[model samples]
Target: MKGNTLQPMTMPFRVGNVAPDPEREHAAPVRIPIGPEATLLKEPLLGRYASTRRDIDLDMDAMRAARSRGELPPFGGPWFGGMEKDVAWVNTTRVIGDASDAEELTRAEVTGRKDSVVMLDALREHSPAFKDGRLLHTSTQIGVRETRCLLGAYTLTGDDIRTQARFDDGIAVGCWPIDVRPAGDVGVHAMYVPLPYEIPYRSLLPRKTDNLLVAGRCISVDREALGSARVGATCAATGRAAGVAAALAATGGKQPRQLDAGQLRTAVRAQGGRVTPPAH
Candidate 1:
């Protein structure tokens, strides 16, 4: 595989599960009350957020609409599934910095928190439902999307996802599209994948690391490929595969790279994971 030439991307944001105040009277009757559960997708107010340094992009109208949800998970699912809530505080403020820079990341944390408050203020101004609303809980730390990645024994690329590439050592499967939030862009740039693709165990094996195995978004993948591989479900699948491999390596007294691929695939399949493309 060729050396990684893509720069790591970063998106710093916060989430607050909000609830409406019972004592407050609504200027406009709550049209669509925040529900028990909802789906998530990209919002339309990102352009406004991108231009204003201290502003956030949230779909205020959708909060009242039943369809309003955020895409924090793969397959366009909601992260806060079973939470019994009325409102979701979706903060769209962003911070960009080098992943290796501690000062920048620290700034992201501080800035992200401050911006989240700014978003809350905007929400209050946008709707009266939250005029007296209270925050149930807020994210303690800023969420960072990408950082330094490992160039492992095998590299998963965007082409692999599009063509549904399968490997003999396949350990996990991902079907999320190539969703990238470019720095200073209005919204995410997405390239939908045709089908689910396999993640090889070789991608988890670092070239120089003897016994160490990498998983999740940090596994060997190019920049374009990371866009699709960097979601919660995909990350979890890769993590489980890595854990299984790690356990097998420890028990067998062998390096992770030296483990049998077939054995690992069988073990993962036994655990109810999809290491190959699903039949259409």
Candidate 2:
């Protein structure tokens, strides 16, 4: 499948302007209530604990009403809420269009900027916290979700995740569920996975390129499986595995595929990674 491109967004707080060594603790559990009309296409906001009342809800009723009246273009979804000290971040605009096409991408970027302005206006009008807030910055670059996936030694599939298949060369674990967005009339289809599943080392090894090792979201995986494995934490784990395997291969004067899976697992474990499956 073709890889996805990023959706550009703006932030409330400016970077670098904030004091160094900012508060290191979450004061309380931040839970933003989503309106019934909000079509959350992804998972809920998650973070560590703090006892302070920093929570804020993203009421999409205004946006939904505007959509119904054809006042705004349907481009992107909102990020419920997030905060870093005095600065809060929310993504309520998305430039819904083809990301691959040059002309469309340009248009999407423009639309994204405009949407951010509108979203900020709405936030300032409705949310008390954002009443005095100013736009700190807009992302310099657009983020791409999917692009090109390498055809590796082994490609992960939805069935592998569903069955919780174990691989002798498993190097990383993924726990996120399949979160595919809706297309046309089809609604968002999300499948929850209770258990963490293995991501095999072979998935990082490109089939034809002996020297190349793939990691992160670009690693070999079917579209359905990609949804679970593409998250930040899972990608980080896979990246660590790839780094370790690459170093071992380089030292041994061997290709990534030539490195023994057992040795790799041993090295990964030494570095505080859990390569073995938990006792069933």
Candidate 3:
């Protein structure tokens, strides 16, 4: 992370789905679960006994029509994934498309709702487990994958992860692969990391903002590097580090940028974090 080097981090838009468990008791608030049982399927209806292709196609066609009418934003092909197997957890929802407009927040909201309904319809029609399932819930809001990233003390790049870059001030670690979705005709590409890479505390310190600290996908990272660090586990780790650093800085009357890296690392480790990067 370095100073005043804010970069644009973009990713394909996606939505998620959550369905009710047929075998489980109908509780007050419907539960949506996620686990290995949730398989990410490319074609919605083409899977074995889960043929809802027609529904998916119709949804896409309708979306395209909406886009033509300026009612919906442009989006890519339909994709679906959730806990579809045995009732191990509550079903969930996931949808992805193009939603880069900052001004069109309402448009994104509409698209997410439309996408969720279409996917839910498909799940109910083809999936035996959800034939009678009800839509217990939907996301209170849409999830954005990428946005404006702070220019920090250091800007992490994809090559840093590929080479297993280490840092003396490393405060967090990320091991997820560099998974990027195709913009248009380009296919989704994922490059695995052979070893975990250290995320420097510098990456979290904004250049011009002394008291502010950034965690999660907004940390100082290039778009490619973001693919790996954007996972939940990594975000949690960064959040822990930031929280500790913020507390220490506040108590000591120091700016976040002025906190000592070693002290921060010690505090993070005491809270069950892995500060040191793994061996190459």
Candidate achieving the largest lDDT: 2
TM-score of each: 0.70, 0.74, 0.64
Weakest 10 consecutive residues of candidate 3 by summed lDDT? 48-57
Model 1, residue 142: displacement in angstroms?
1.1
Q: lDDT of each prediction vs. the true structure?
A: 0.61, 0.64, 0.59
User: Quick one: RMSD of model 1?
Assistant: 9.2
Question: How would the candidate models be sorted by lDDT, starting from the highest?
Answer: 2, 1, 3
Give the per-residue Cα lDDT of candidate 1 at 206: 93
Tens-digit per-residue lDDT, 193-276, candidate 2:
435689999999988888889899899998878867887898999999999999999999999999999999999889998875
Ranking of predictions according to TM-score: 2, 1, 3
- Model 3: per-residue Cα lDDT at residue 252: 97
Total clashes, candidate 3?
27
Error of 2 at 17 (Å): 15
How much lDDT does candidate 2 score? Answer: 0.64
Q: Tell me the lDDT of model 3 at 113.
A: 64
Q: Which segments of model 3 are wrong by more than 4 Å? A: 1-102, 122-134, 185-194, 278-280
